[model samples]
Target: MSKQLVVYISATGTTRRVAQNLAKAIDADLAEIVPAPPFTAQDIDWTDPTSRASRQHADRAMRPPISASPSVDGYDEIFVGYPLWWDTAPREVRTWLESHDFTGKTITTFATSSSSTRGALGEQLHDSAPDAHWVNGRRFAANASEAELKAWADSIA
Candidate 1:
C-alpha cells in the first residue's frame, strides 16, 4: 500500500474535522499545518473589510504562520486540506506548498466552505503546484457527517 499523509490547516476546526475523517477512512498518517502563533477568533473576522485579517489578505494575500514543516519525499500521496478564503486557499497553504518539494507526488485537495465552490480553489492549487499530480477537489459542509466524509474518501481511494 502506498503511504499517505493528510496535512491540513483549519481555523474554526471545520476543515480539521474533515481532515481527521479523511485520514481515518484512508488509514493515513495525520499531520497538522499549525500556525506559529495560531489565529484567534478575532483574527478571522471576514466581516470587517478594514480589519487586519482582511487587509492582510487583501494586500499580502495569505499570511498564516506555519508551525510544522513537511518533507513530501517520503509520502506517495498527500491530502492537503484547508478552508477556502477569498475564493482561493489561505496563504499559509500556499506557503506550505512552496516550502516543500512535491516533484512526483500525487496531491489531493479538499476544502470546507460555507458558500464558495471548489472550482476556483482547485484551479489555483493546480496553478501553484503544477508539478504535482493534482487530483480533483471536494467541498464539504462545515458540519459534515463522518459517514459522508468516509464515503467520499472511499470513493477517492
Candidate 2:
C-alpha cells in the first residue's frame, strides 16, 4: 500500500473534520498545519478587512509562520486540505508547502467551502512546491461522507 498523508489547517474545525474523514477513508496518516501562535476567532473574521486572515490574503507575499511542519518524507502521496481563502490556499499553507521538498511526491489538494468553488487552488500552489506532481483538487461540503471521500481518493490515487 502506498503511504499517504493528509495535512490540513482548520480555523474553526470544519476543515479539520473533513481532513479526518479523508485520512480515515484512505487509511492515510494525518497532520495539521497549525499557524504559529494559533488563530483566534477574531483573527479569521472575514468581514473585518483588518483581520489577520484578511490582511494576509491581500498581501500576496505574506506567508504566515506555521507552528510546526510535518515531515513529508516516505509519503507516496500527500493530500493538503484547507478552507478556501480568497479562492486559494491560506498563506500558512504556503509556508508549510515551501518548508518541504516534495520533489517527486504526488500532491492532491482538497478544500471546504460553503459557496466558492475550488478555483485554481492546485495550480496556485505550484510555485510553492514546484517539483511535486499535482493532481486537480476538489471542494467538498462540510458534511461529505467517508464513502464520498474514499471514492475521490481512489479515483486520484
lDDT of each: 0.78, 0.89
Off by over 4 Å in 2: none
Best by lDDT: 2
Instruction: Assess candidate 2 and give its lDDT.
Output: 0.89
Tens-place lDDT digits, model 2, residues 4-88: 9999998889999999999999899999999997988988788999988799888989988998798999998999998887888
Total clashes in model 2, counting residue pairs 3 or more apart in sequence or in different chains: 0
Report how far off residue 86 is in candidate 1 (Å).
1.2
Q: Which window of ten consecutive residues has the lowest lDDT sum in model 1?
A: 118-127
Give the distance in Å from residue 79's predicted Cα in candidate 1 to where it truly belongs: 0.9
Looking at candidate 2, what is the lDDT of residue 84?
Answer: 83
Candidate 2: pairs in clash: none
> Would you list the clashing residue pairs of candidate 1?
62-91
lDDT tens digits by residue: candidate 1, 1-157: 7899988988889899888888887788888887767867876788988753576668754555688866676898898988876666677787788878788888888888888875423667675667888878788887777678678767776
